[model samples]
Target: MRRLPPLNALKAFEAAARHQSFTAAAHELNVTQTAVSQLVKSLEERLGVALFERRGNQLSLSPRGMGYLPAVSDAFDRIAAATAILDETDARQITLGCGPTFAMRWLIPRLPDFQRAHPECEVRLSTTLAVRELQSQSPLPDGVDAAVRLYDPSKPEPGLMADPLFTADLFPVCAPGLAARLKTMADLARETLLEVRHAPGEWRDWLSAAGLGSMVPSSSLSFDFHAFALQAALDGAGVALARRPFVTDDLKAGRLIAPFALSLPKGGAWCLLYRPEAAGGSAFLKLRDWLIGAAMPPTA
Candidate 1:
């Protein structure tokens, strides 16, 4: 119906042009540098014009690109603004893409507090098998509003705002009943250790980081999800490496106990991810700030 090229190609060109570097645009997009170049090239081909002139390491906007920038940027901005106004409602909704174990242990218990504080808003959660990027309703997806991810602050998502919460420390744990019998991390080689299937190399990575690289076990008893592994540990079947928030309740009820003082992979912190388009929305801002504070460590 219109003379414009594909939206994806246009978006890629816009980001690349704005930054003046495909590498920077690719980093912002969470995609490959080659992908950004391909998208921009596709856009140029569709338009039958060159958007950027590459000179060694630098990228210069062509005459056509300079003229097209304002219109393209303005169009996306207008759509974003319109969506915010249309989606605004008396009842606010915050949907989080949560992991299975986190949903079971940390999130559900604290939700009552969130409801009490923001009764005007309706808070919901989505527990997907594959993380949010692969989910139907991701952080930037329609109706999702926002999502929580293990993100690094120094690294930013180009079009999305990344608000980091607290960090999670990964440590090994087991049922309290087996605590007195199993004394050291080395003892696990003889016994069954509950392995999380998704993080297949986690055990190896943890052991290596802990300076126990030479102490590889025969094999671990694996489970598809953290919940299943936690359940297996609770049954006194084996020891499991528990991540904070995910294992908070288990430790609280004396259901599980940490076996070693050495912790590995200490920076898997949770973050709130949302498109910059929703940054100005009063509801989205409130939810984003609330969640970041909500996940603050109880130890603090």
Candidate 2:
């Protein structure tokens, strides 16, 4: 340690010099006025300098005190600035787990908005095919702060907080060129039906809702990923059964069109889930609120 007066004495001198009143400095530092006076006296005695001149209740910094104030204030400011830089370097990060399909088609597309709103927060996204894996891993793998998952509301996870993001709905969507030829549900049978192999029932449910339950397509193709099937539909290869939220942007952009008005609601919904303790911090709360706000309808 270098030779210097005690930190408390230095603080007392600085506060007293700035305010020019021992009572005011005491109020600001949450100490007794006598304590401020004594600390300043000790500092002046240790430095062999007259730091203040007192007359009755009035107090003024001496010539030496006036010169010392600027250096002391500058040092404190530099210390604070350095601490802030370290805080930002060690800033808290939140990891969100989501399904690969939803991550690509929904979450990823909207993430930039969240980033812009919270530049101080760092977000790491982890995508997986098994949504259940988000909860199944002991101690939560990959430091996942929270998860967006599809779950049956009737059988929600015990003791975990679940907030509905959006429900799933199935409807037939095809490229604009292909959609122009589809005037009715009957026309669906004439186009190649692109199916998501994992969710085979979606097409059947959508067909039943469209009044084409027993109708069989002339040709069909299947893909392991919904993204793949959707891409195929976008490319005019075939008509794909689109899920709500995932297909919302495409429909809005006119890249895909639902020729018929029928839509089938699925049994499960997409939900945001996290442990109770995980929701305590400001960073996580900001992300949670942003997600909820994004899910809501826009004002007129």
Candidate 3:
């Protein structure tokens, strides 16, 4: 290692040289003026050079001190910048806002994998009603670094950038017992129809696709959220209109059954939404990439 002057001495020299006054340097460094003078004197003694010209009531750098200022100042600036970066990275917590159903049905189960992979970054989740989020004119609420929501690219939200994660395909699903009662798609007309009130047209569209446009269910139940509707269906309350992402696990585990093979594409996609500038942050990018990867189909 190269020999260097004491850090305190160097700091005193730099500060005193910059202001051309030990009194001013002492004020900035929170030290006594005598201490600043002693530190600078020690630095000068070590360097074997007179660093300052001592004229009464005036202080000025010598030729050698003038030459040293730029390098010392640059080194301190670089050190400050590097420390700031370290502090920022160490404080890497992302607050994500999403709908309750998406959080419950899709994200929460898979979050452990993300946590395992990036222990340095913490993810705090906040849930809201999808209907309110979709229809709100304001930006994401305070403390929400980003959001995941259904977005129609045809009608983009102002000042927001969206990265599509998954498209939801709608299908009918219910408890296996309720499903067994239904022999075919046309048989759905005899049972209660379950729906989320915000997207009331989904049932009609699904019916029309199944060639039962004129058919109406024996009765109906409407909930405020897809999660509630799906839960009701799980309890054998009725046949819920299931979205692909929300039902994937339940369908595979036999918790719910889709009797019909038909699945209709919804109008928009579930996407990650954020301000355009947030895309540049490393924390956001990591979360975004992980979400996209999680949404991908498994390989054979």
Model 3 — TM-score against the truth? 0.67
Model 1 TM-score, 2 decimals: 0.68
Assess each prediction's global lDDT (C-alpha) against the native.
0.75, 0.81, 0.86
Weakest 10 consecutive residues, lDDT, candidate 1?
129-138
Better of 1 and 3 by TM-score: 1
Ranking by TM-score: 1, 3, 2
What is the C-alpha local distance difference test score of candidate 1? 0.75
lDDT of 2 by residue, 1-300 (tens): 798889999899999988989999999999999999999999999999999988898899888888999999877765653354345343356778877878888889999999999988888888753445534663234356678877666775654677788887777889999999987779888899999777788888878777778999989999877889999999999999877777878988999998877778887788887766566556677889999999875688
Candidate 3 runs further than 4 Å off: 1-91, 129-131
By lDDT, rank the candidates, best first: 3, 2, 1
TM-score of each candidate structure, all chains considered together: 0.68, 0.65, 0.67
Q: Any runs in candidate 2 off by more than 4 Å, and if so which?
A: 1-91, 129-142
Give the clash total for candidate 3.
Answer: 0
| 63-106: candidate 3 lDDT, tens digit per residue | 99899999899778756643543466634767888899999999
